[model samples]
Target: MGMRLYAIVIYLFLYLPIGIIVLFSFNAGRHASDFHGFSVKWYGKVLSNPFAMDALTTSVTVAFITALLASVFGTMAALGLQQFKGRFRALFDAAIYIAIMIPGIVIGIATLIALVTAFGYLNPALAAAWPEWLGDAPRLKMGRVSLIAAHTMFTMALVIVIVRARLAGMDRTLIEASADLYATPMGTFWQVTLPQIFPAVLAGFLLSFTFSFDDFIIAFFVAGSETTLPIYVFSSIRRGVTPEINAIGTMVLAVSLSLLIVAQVMLRRRDRPAA
Candidate 1:
């Protein structure tokens, strides 16, 4: 009874603020401190706000691209690492964890500085190499491309970790059987390995999408002119929180929750025995 009560208390402590935010998102009044009765006016406002809509679109596009690129690169890296042994494998594994363990702020600052310096050096050469017809297309700088690269750098580690965990648990006998049947490396990967590890890849993609969508620190440093949803939300709060901001937060929370649920379902399905 005591343990149950403690667990309940812990859960409430963890989730009460989120509950309050969601509850007050529908508040009719502009003030978040007091509930001024329920209304969806704030949601309407969020949808109608052009800046907010633009930010949302930017965030979704970045997250989608980041997830896709990270999933492909990470899955490939995991497969390559799985074939290695001993010290090399251990060293690579440690590197992946280091990326995951590093603070986001540190990563953001380092990435920003690195991108600015690299672009400063490379942009001149890139311009020189460009065709006359292109007419000096804008060179890469700190913007959407930098943001996507930064997001993929960190999120790819997460994907690798998830897919590697799945791979570690996979049956080696299946691969051996495929080899015995004279399957090519590509054939074995596509026909035998991919289907088995696909659930982890999907889960990693969803997780990467969520991380990129909600990320603020790295995006803030690297985004330059482009405003992502999290950056917009932060700016709104800095200006002063409104009911519309609350409504946006609620919608974001809903999307994140839905993705989590879908990922969980996929994992469970993967774990289920074949009937």
Candidate 2:
């Protein structure tokens, strides 16, 4: 009974703020401190706000591309690591964890500097090589492309971890059987390996999408002129919080929680024993 009470207290402590945000999202009052009444005006306000809409669109686009790229490349990476043996593999595994554990600000700064330096050199080289149309073309500096790359850099580590966990628990006999049947590497992967680990891939994709969508620190550094949803929200806060902001927060929380719940359900189902 004591433990149950403690667990209840912990859950309330964790979710109380979220509950307040959701509850007050519908509050007719503009002031966050008071709830004058219940209304959906705030939702309409959020929908009608051009800045919010544009930011939402940009965030969705980035998250979609990030998820797709992370899923494909991360799965490939997991497969490579699974087959690898030796000290290098151990080093690589440690590196993935380090990337995951690193602060977002550090990653953002490092990514920004690296991209700027690379583009600085590459732009000059390209201009020299092609003095015509290519020379005058705007060189890649920092913007959506850089933001996507930064997101992929960290999120890919998460994907690799998820897919690798799945791979580690997979049956090797099935792969051996495919090899015995004279299946090509590609054929075996498509037929035998992919289906087995697809749940983890899907989970990774969902997680990547969520991370990219809600990310603010890295996106702020690398976004250039583009404004993602999180960055927009942060900018809006300087002007003071309104019901519209609350509504947006509620919506973001809903989407993130929904994705997380779905991912958890998928993973649980994958782990369940078949009768």
Candidate 3:
């Protein structure tokens, strides 16, 4: 009974706000002042908004790129960390944890300065060298590119932690067996190592993608002028809550929740005893 109460309290705290958002999202009469009748008209308005669409497009592009980079790098880092067993293991692990724990705001500001500064350098260099596309295009914000890079920093840490955890529980004999079979080092990794880790990689990618997609704080920091869906929703709140924003919010929430659920389902399938 005590644990049940604790669970109920936690669930309520976590999901009550979402319940409210989902409720108000369907509220009719087109007023944030109070609840009205239920209608889907707000959803229709959201679909028609070009600005919201653009923000979503930008977010998707950034999320995909961030997820891909982080998954790849994190997997490599995980494998390398596993190979290392010494007093220095803690040091490397600590570094990864530090990156994970650092505030998003700090990461964002640092990324913005680095991006702008790099562009400042590249802009002049390209002008002197190619005197072509880079010169005419004039890369400043690089919009989605900057956002992706910044997001990857956090996502990479997430991937590393997840992949390392998966690796820790894995059977070590397969790797040794492949080595004993005289398979080349590269072959062992590609054939033996990578297959075991692929699910984790996919999980990391999806997890990173959803997290980055829903993220507003870090994105806001490094996003420059390229607005994301979260940023768009935030910007719209000041003007008053439109049903359109509610519709968009509902979609975002649904997508994130769905991806998370799917990832968990896949993990559970792998955990089942073989027939």
- What's each prediction's TM-score? 0.93, 0.93, 0.87
Candidate 2: list runs displaced more than 4 Å. Answer: 133-135
- lDDT for every model? 0.90, 0.91, 0.83
- Backbone clash pairs in model 3 (N, Cα, C under 3 Å; residues 3+ apart or in different chains), count: 0
Q: Which ten residues in a row have the lowest lDDT in candidate 3?
A: 266-275
Cα deviation in Å at residue 243, candidate 3? 2.4
Candidate 2: the clashing residue pairs are: none
lDDT per residue, candidate 2, 72-176, as tens digits?
999999999876889999899888988899999999898989889999999888777775854475677799999998899888999999998888888889999
What is the per-residue lDDT of model 1 for residues 6-75, given as tens digits with 9 covering 90 to 100? 9999999999988988998889877888778989998988899999999999999999999999999999
Q: Name the lDDT value of residue 227 in candidate 2.
A: 98
Worst 10 residues of 2 by lDDT: 266-275
lDDT of 3 by residue, 9-42 (tens): 9999999888877888898977755888888888
Clashing pairs in 3: none
